[model samples]
Target: MTEAEFIAALRRMPLHPGAHGLMDDSAVIDAGPLVVTTDTLVEGVHFLPQDPPGDVAWKLVATNLSDLAAKGALVEGVLLNYPLGDSAWDHAFLDGLSLALARFDARLIGGDTVSLRGPRVLTLTAFGREAAAPVRSGARAGDALWVTGTIGDAGLGLAIAMGGTGPEALRDAYRRPQPRLTEGRALAPVVHAMMDVSDGLLIDAARMAQASGLAVTIDLDAVRLSPAARALGGEDRAARLAAATAGDDYELLFALPPDVTPPVAATRVGRFDAGAGLSLFDTAGPIPLPPRLGFEHAAPR
Candidate 1:
């Protein structure tokens, strides 16, 4: 069967509470008082075989946890959907996951297991509590654009892993990406809208602006880069990697009113203008946007 057809099989299963449909990773359920979120990651798509299983498990769990973080949800627990390979592989993966869960007091409730003929896939459903979680489309036109942590490190880290002249210190960027959970939780309460930067910063910025019905203008000179990222491109070439092709940063991107100060080391790289569409401004001027796009899934590694 085709991939799409294979996915359609889950539709035959009986639905339960919180299940949006058989197709969703997250379900809407009442946890006494809040909403929740869940996300999943596949083997080849989310991580490389060369990457350690420990890191793979962490990424799988943390990526979903980041979603809850964006919504100001206090993490209650996580349900792991682990597709086993060998017993040893599964045990080691869980060992790594145990460390992360313990760090946040998140217990693994329960999930099903299945054997796969192909590569490994990890799915996680993270539940949290909040009276009102941050929604993606709540920003106003004058909301300030901000992000926690520096951009481009993870992108350059991937380049290094793929033999693109990046340093070892930066290599941890690909091996271990930190989900800005605390930052997201803090920002959600005050900001208009918030999201974690899994894709390239410029692209995610554009998405936030678009979802909130405003234009985003990023100042190329204003972006903060890790020393490792700066060393990779050399001199002043951040404009080359600032927004395009970078992925897995896992930091929060948010919007706040003009008068508010960011709680973290947030940079004002852009603004929500009165119009629609994103404008990337470098010293030379605004770079023309690519038609109908940003970093899409499987657009050539």
Candidate 2:
């Protein structure tokens, strides 16, 4: 089954009201401002097998926290599901986990561990608090689309990790992504909808538009690229498209009224309209949609 099929199947199972039909990334429980989210990373899939254990641990924690950030929730604590591995790797992972938790001001409440088997798999569940959590489906037509921080740094970082030449900053970006918790909190009350860009920006934005029953048009020239990314990839239409489709950005993508200024620094890349699908344009006028929008999981046969 494909990812969509799997999700559709899961939707048939018993679900709580907080599940939001599993349409959103995080669950907003009615039990006193609580929000919860979980994420899993496979060694070969999410991270390179040769990557440092410490960075892997940090990535695991950050990915989950990114979900909470999209919900504009405050990080309270996390539960880790770790696999016991070699003493050296285990020790390094714990060290990285310690630093990540401390940096995020989150504590490790509890979790279960198991013996390492096959490819290493790690999971983290984060709990947070927010009175009025925003969902991706809340976006509306005429809302101006916004995104936090620069895009595509992590994509270049991934290339560096895979042995391509690049700056350490890019590599660090792919290894240790910083979740936009502060930005999310500040934008929560003002934005119509929001979500972290884990998958490619185009795909996530398309999701927001689909969920809200609207159409979105992204201005390729408007998609911001970091200095490093621009220096390496240039500012051509191809480069901008690459950045927009590269995943693991971990930045918040939100929708706000065109007249309102965002409290935090963000780039306005697109807008929603009363239509059905995503559209693309640049300084050169309309562009055809790319064949592939973003990274997606393929089910094993």
Candidate 3:
């Protein structure tokens, strides 16, 4: 089954109210003021086999925390599910996990380990606390779509990781993505809707539109790009399109009223309207949606 199909099937089973219909990034359970999220990374898929073990561990933790960030929650702790591997690689991963936990102000409370049977797979579950959390479905008509930080650097970075030449900053962007925790906490109170740009700006924005029952139009020219990205990929229409569809950017995407200034730095890339789908435009005119909006898991045949 496709990922979507699998999720749809899961929805048929009993679900906790906090699951948010299995739609949002994290599950917010009110009992403990808890916000929970989990993410999994697989070898030769989420990360290259040759990638540093420490970097892989960092990514596993950071990606899960990014979900908490989107919920505007403070880090409480994490539980890791690890597979036993080469002793050297295991030691390196633990070292990286220590650094990541310290950097994020999160504690490694507990977890389980198992023998590796095939490709390495790592999972992390993060717990956080916040009185209130925002949901992606809160976007309303006339809300301005905003995003934190730059886009597409990681996409270019991935290319460099695979032997293509580019700046070290881009390589780091791919290897170590920073979760916008502070930005999420600050924006949660003011933004109508919020989510991290994990999959891609275009696809995630489209999802927000679909969730909120509104339409969105993104101005390609308005999408932000870092100097490194522009220097390597150029700032033309193609570059902007590539950036919009490139996933792994963990920056927050939010919707706010046009008149209100965001408490944090953000780029206004689009606006929500009264209709129901995603539209794209540039200085020239409307552009067709790309065949693939972002990264999606394909089921084994």
Candidate 4:
């Protein structure tokens, strides 16, 4: 079954009391406002087999933290699911995992390790604390949409890792994504809605729009691209569209009142409107929606 189908199947089963109806990325527990999120990365799927094990470990931790960040929670600890591999690779992964946890001020309290005969799979469950988890469904019409950092850098980074030419910064972005933990917590109070842009900018925005039951009109010219991404994607309508649809950027995308300036570095790229669906436009005029929005695991057969 496809990933979405599998998730849907799980939703049909009786859910744990704290489960968020399988709607949000993380689930909230009744115990002291704890929130938890889990993500799994598989070899040759999420990451290239040739990718460094240390980087893989870094990504595994950062991605889960990003989910917690979206909930406006402070990460307290993580539970690791590590599959044993060769000694050297396993050691490298542990070292990287240690550095990542240290950097985020989170501890690895507990986990499971087991031997696997197939592709390497790494999973992490992050625990966080917050009085209330921010909801993506909170966006409203007339909210200004904003995105942290530049978009499309990670997509270019993936290309560099795949033998395509690119700068090291781009490659580093793809390998080690910086989760917006501090920013998420800071913005939670003022923003109307918030979510991490792990997928493409356009697709994630569409999700927020759908959740809010409003239309999102994105101005393509306002979408930010790194120097490396600009060089790789060029400065045309199609190029900008390509950047918008490229996924794996872990920056936070949010909506706020137009008068409220973001406390952190961000760019205003769009606005939520009183309608359903999403619309794309540029300086010249409206642009046609792409056939495919972003990374879709369960595509129509």
In the order shown, the candidates' Cα RMSDs to the true structure are 7.2, 9.1, 9.2, 8.6
Candidate 1 clash pair list: 18-27
Q: Candidate 1 on 74-182: residue-level lDDT in tens?
A: 7776666767576566556766776677666665544556668888877777777762477767778877888887877777777677666768777677767777777
Which should have the higher lDDT, number 1 or number 3?
3
Across 44-84, the per-residue lDDT of candidate 3 in tens digits comes to 98999988988998889888888888888888777677787
Checking candidate 2 for backbone clashes, the offending pairs are none
| Every candidate's lDDT | 0.70, 0.84, 0.84, 0.81
Which wins on TM-score, candidate 1 or candidate 4?
4
lDDT of 4 by residue, 1-301 (tens): 2344434533443444455555665544544768778888999888999988889989998998988887888877776677777867766776677678778987654555677889998888888886247678888889999999998888889989999998999999999999999988888777888988877899999999999999999999999888888887687898888788887888999999888899989999999999999899998999989987787751111
Give residue 171's lDDT in candidate 4 (0 to 100).
93
Writing each residue's lDDT as its tens digit, candidate 2 over 200-286 gives 999889989999999999998999999999998888999888889898899999999888899999999999999878999998999
lDDT of candidate 1 at residue 252, scale 0 to 100: 84
Reference-based TM-score, model 1: 0.83
